[model samples]
Target: MPKFFNTAGPCQSDIHYTLPTGDRLPQLEKLIAQRNYFVIHAPRQTGKTTAMLTLAQELTASGAYTAVLLSLEVGAVFPHDPGAAERAILDEWKQSIKFRLPENLYPPEWPDTNAGSMIGTLLSNWAKKASRPLVVFLDEIEALSDETLISVLRQLRSGYPNRPQGFPHSLALIGMRDVRDYKIAGGGSQRLNSSSPFNIKVESLTLQNFSLADVKNLYKQHTEATGQIFTPEAIERAFYLTDGQPWLVNAIARQATEVLAPDVATPITVDLINQAKEILIQRQDTHLDSLAERLREDRVKAVMQPILAGQDLPNVPNDDIQYLVDLGLCKIDNGQGLEIANPIYQEVLPRVLSYTTNASMGRIESRWLSDKGELMPMELLEAFLGFWKQHGEPLFKSTPYPEIAPHIVLMAFLHRVVNGGGTIEREYAIGSGRMDICLHYGKVILAMELKVWREGKRDPLDEGLQQLDKYLSGLNLDTGWLVIFDRRPDLLPLSDRTTTEIATSPAGRSIIVIRG
Candidate 1:
């Protein structure tokens, strides 16, 4: 059978297009040789499990180490019962060893001990009995609750001094975050600790998303296996859309090859890649849905709300922002400012929050469309003005992120207009002070920039117009709209305050200044 893209779990080279797992982490052998107990973490689905598993196989095959990959996830189920969690975890570990290792390499039965300290004892016994030095990768270490996690980490730290002879020579704690960012809660406390119990880590290593070359090499595997070709533009577009996210990279190609364009001879194109993205978002695949779930987190909120409103970032802790970066929700930009990690996430974040509002909206007639079914820019603007005058206030209260409520309402309204037939691309970042949108409709492109006029702040009309001019230049458009929302107190009702005016940008671009 021809190999295809794998998105759900660790990639199997036999049936998946995979990069050499060792290429991504060249220091693993050196780290192991040094008897280091380190960490390897990245956002979910970025090939952590795949790399570790491959590394384990390679080390065991070389007869230099008795390597195994084990999971701590079972322990999460017994969060309050550390003893029970450890028993379950060790049982799972034994089963895993039975399946993965030869009889000579199998661990002796775990020593009988109190459940709380079983993991440490188990590893100690295994290393002592093994023919070669033992190396273990502990996966899903973050799933354990605070007390359980603390227990496990303390055990590992306690066992750290007994290397080579009594404990695993090298160990890796694998999860979605570095050791420092683990969310340790419960036990009647709601505060995060900066210094965790597992501070003995020699180093923390992160697996990066696939590079452009890595993505191309992966796609080439499919082309070599089958006659199907992915256009160079398609690969580049895929990389751009996903920012090299491994799951997304595979998902896009998988959808395009297996669903969007199944014929072996039909080459994948940029348009097909985009369609795959839309389909993935619409379907809310497990990977994307997992990320959407993080939006409600307080740490995630502190960083994300500013980006949504295009306001200056709040005084959030650096570690909080770094946590989001580790989770792949955001990334450090060229200038070290944080932004949404990729275009797909940029779209998913707003739409997921506005989902209920988008659904609750009452029936709206297609007043913005011309007789020929094309979107009329002026008509669309008028329709939005009418909607805002009628429903914007109530809709604002319906959203959780009030700072970006207006932006969400506007996006919700535009969502109704586009409805999958068109596309809306948003550009906003911390410190941008405005959100810019580019609407793509049938044979027409409309640009818009939204700013809020606060009571104590100066009206941003002039600044908005200047910014819109620069935005229009990029779109190669001669006209666009600058929407300034008047959020000042003592303002009249929406009907009275909402209005529009035609103005010109400094670069002579036609600007529709909508004051609402």
Candidate 2:
């Protein structure tokens, strides 16, 4: 039987393998021939290692070069000791070569010593003895310590001039980040410039998730080997939930094939895919755990707050956004703003961050807004404001993420309101105008746009009006409400403040502005 699961690493020949559907391969192949140092980066499990391995195999099979795959992850464990790390790396190199190439074809002169200098010496000797141009692929390059990483980069730079005559012809560094972002601290406050060390890098390529067609093609592999097949709806559901994430696609398929249907009479359907997704999430598998791990970082929170609040994130550095994208936590939309990459990420984030607090909110069914199937817009806003008045101060104090306290409370309250009856879809991005929250009940749609109250200014009102109008227009609705949290201690409510319906933008819909 063909292997179906590939969670630990790339799929092998006997395993069910899906060809890379990304467009980077042709450019990669071209770069390899030119003997250039390049970088391959992507979020974990997006298949960077698999792509590199496959490319290495293809390059070796073409009779143009002796390609090898090596990993530097082991070096990350001993960040302070470059010597031992280099030894571990050399040992892994030997194992990789033995696994891929025949014993006779393996270079016989490879140095057996674990010394730091031996790394460059061994590669140099092997390249000189090789019959063709040599290519070296270093996977998990980001895991190496600053000293070791710099050592590796400098060795490659030192050997670059020799090229096919004395050293490896080309080299590739594969990792979770681009070379420029590497921060290596050494003896007594000395810092290494990662990009400068590897200045010879010709191109940086990022591997993307599988496409819809690729998901179909992958599923077909299982069907071709076994007699079972995925129904069209099942395939569509898989794409919807996974957004073509390689691991998720394979995992959901494997669940459906092996676990969901033990008999051939049952057809794989959308329901089965949904069941598999829930199981996967509940299992807290490595994929979900890995994605959630970044949420604990302050930088990740800095980028996510605005998206959650439906407000523009000002002064956020470009590097921060790039970091989140590399982690696969967010993606750029229309080159304008960043949004969570997929539903699974969206669902996992809020739950992982607020599980304890949400649970303490006391069963939503017994809470303040449980009487009606869906709370009326103004009523829900008023209740949340009241709850904030009583508990908001404490909640904000307890929150680790103060910038997003209001956002978390609002989401929690809404989640409480719709706990069992409906769903709320949220959309926000760093540097976007505002966060958009759409509460969906069978047919009744309540769209809310949230904005932080700017002290001593009416700009929040104008911003709120503009955002509510946009939300209404996007949902094809005629009217919507904007709720603003006034943080000013001195400002008293306008008891006579009536809800006003006014045209916001010429092309946008009119909005109901509620000032609290």
Q: How many residue pairs clash in each candidate?
A: 0, 3
Cα lDDT of candidate 2 equals 0.73
Best by TM-score: 1
State every prediction's TM-score relative to the real structure: 0.97, 0.81
Best by the lDDT measure:
1
* Model 1 lDDT on a 0 to 1 scale: 0.88
Q: Residues 1-516, candidate 1: write the lDDT tens digits.
A: 779899889988788888997779988899999999999989999999999998998899999999999999998877778898898898888789887778899888776798668888888888888899999999998888767788898999888889889999999999998776665676423434544577778889999999999999999989989989999999999999999999999999999999989998999999999999988877888998999999988888888998888888878888888889999999998894889999999988888999878877899999999888899988888889989999988898878788888888899998888886888889998888899999998899999999999878998999998898899999899999898988888889887889888898899877889887
- Candidate 2 regions with alpha-carbon error over 4 angstroms: 3-5, 20-24, 110-114, 186-194, 226-241, 255-284, 359-390, 413-423, 430-433, 438-448, 459-483, 489-516
TM-score of candidate 1 against the unseen true structure: 0.97
lDDT over C-alpha atoms for residue 48 of model 1: 96
Deviation in angstroms for 512 in model 2?
A: 9.9
TM-score, cand. 2: 0.81
